[model samples]
Target: MPRVFLSFRKVDSRWMRDRVYQGLIGRFGAGEVFKSGESIPAGADFAEILRRQAAECELMLVLIGPAWLEARGDDGMRLIDRADDWVRVEIETALKAGNRVVPVLLGDATMLPEASALPHEIAHLARLQFLRVPETHLAEELERLCAAVADLMPDIGHGSASPTAPAAPAAEPTVTMTAQVSGGGSAYQAAGDQTIRLA
Candidate 1:
């Protein structure tokens, strides 16, 4: 199973991000699902861990809420504008590794900004297709997201919730025919009896 990475700005989309993380964790298991804060040890190096996870994971779900783009850093600049921002680093790492990045829209987040509105490193994010999950439809959306993940990454089993493969058509039964013939010169034989056994 490919590791699934959850990426989002901490202040702007924490609630929705946590919800999405919980949903994915239930389907992909805690070990396979990677999220900051939840999976990291208190003393771990956040940057190093993020780089490792982003480089290794096969898919990254970027949670973009209404305030995501405008979320600011400690220096009062937009977080996405800062080249060293962890969120930017995570996205850049994943993109460099050629991992799939899924933009998840929340609370009416319509679409990402155009390349001109973003820094060069992550500008490509603007054109990627995204998934939206309105708060009211979170559960339904999560189910759909899980289905998409299953389709994209076939080896990840969702425990008891895994999609069932279509049952193969039953094999045709085998038949044996026997003909009874009288000891006569005529070559004709009585109608044969047949027996069929289901496999």
Candidate 2:
């Protein structure tokens, strides 16, 4: 399965983030998608975890909101100040690791400024490929995003056949067991005796 790193301004798009996370989980299964608040453990070293996730991810999806350009960190520092800031670090590491960096424009955000106009650490983001989400069809737009993610990881269950089939007298229940490790360090395994793991 290919890992994906999700980068966004938390305060600016919390609802959108949750929706995107749920959509990705529905398409790619839970383990392959990583978000800062949900994928990283509470007390873990954030910078290190972000770096590790970025290095392992096959793609990085940046959710750009209206305020994203002016977002600031908890310490009142601009997000572009340090390379270790979540968005900056993830994009930088993804680029260095040779992974695809996709900038998704959510809402009615304008084009990103030129690299020379951006802060040093995040200037490279200006050159990445960008996709814009339509204002009305949020779910449909998310589906498109999921499709893009699926394109990168064809085997990770984005379009895999469901284990269950319509009820038929001669058909047996084809149950599949999948294990998922949550960001909080919880292991979730399918609850069934005759479960076959998906390849």
Candidate 3:
């Protein structure tokens, strides 16, 4: 099972979700991160998969784009307010299971609504501090988010925390020398991992 669950509303933040998902996959490996539709099996039950992943994951990132709170269903009710909304179920399950649920504010998403504005099952989402992924500084902010997730779930392997290969040794510095020649000054340059003493 994946270590991290990405809870998102497709219409509201699919692009942002995909971007974050790729960054997380890069850090945590593709098998360690879960995004509902993309990670689920073709013939498997969607609701069961979502609930199981949400409940079992170590971290749940709720992608809150600008429209997340207010996006309405066909009946004009806020999607978050609906009991059957997948996003709602995902978050609620994670929260109920005592998993670490983080609200990630996607591009231009300012903040979460008040607790009272949300359904009781997921209302605590409003009280949680959020990580912002602004479009302007996605890479930098994404690194911060990835680091934070790794810190919170250090037992899980992360690229930054556990590199695939040991880092290469630093290159030796180049050395240049100028010596007086019979006709004119001469210059010489050498580069290698070596120590030289001029006599």
lDDT of residue 95 for candidate 1: 95
Quote the positional error of residue 175 for candidate 2 in Å. 28
Flag regions of model 1 displaced more than 4 Å: 158-199
Residue pairs in candidate 2 whose N, alpha carbon or C atoms collide under 3 angstroms? none
lDDT of each residue in 1-199, candidate 2, tens digit only: 3377888877666677688889887776667778888777788998888888888887788888777777776888777666656677777778788887888887755566568867676677889878776567898998987877677667666334323345766756767666555567764465454574533
lDDT of 1 by residue, 1-199 (tens): 3388888887776777787878876776777778888878899998888899999998898888878788886779888888788888999999999999988887654577677887899988888988887777789888887778878888775454455569999966555644455667454343344363323
Compared with the true structure, model 2 gives a TM-score of 0.71
Quantify all predictions' global Cα lDDT against the true fold: 0.79, 0.74, 0.83
List where candidate 3 sits over 4 angstroms from the true fold. 158-163, 166-199
Candidate 3 lDDT tens digits, 41-150: 89999878888899999889998888888999788888888788888898889999999999999986467778998999989999998888888878887898899988
Candidates 2 and 3 compared by TM-score, better number: 3
Q: Which ranking of candidates, highest lDDT first?
A: 3, 1, 2
The collision pairs in model 1 are none
Give stretches of model 2 more than 4 Å off: 73-77, 158-199
TM-score of each: 0.75, 0.71, 0.78
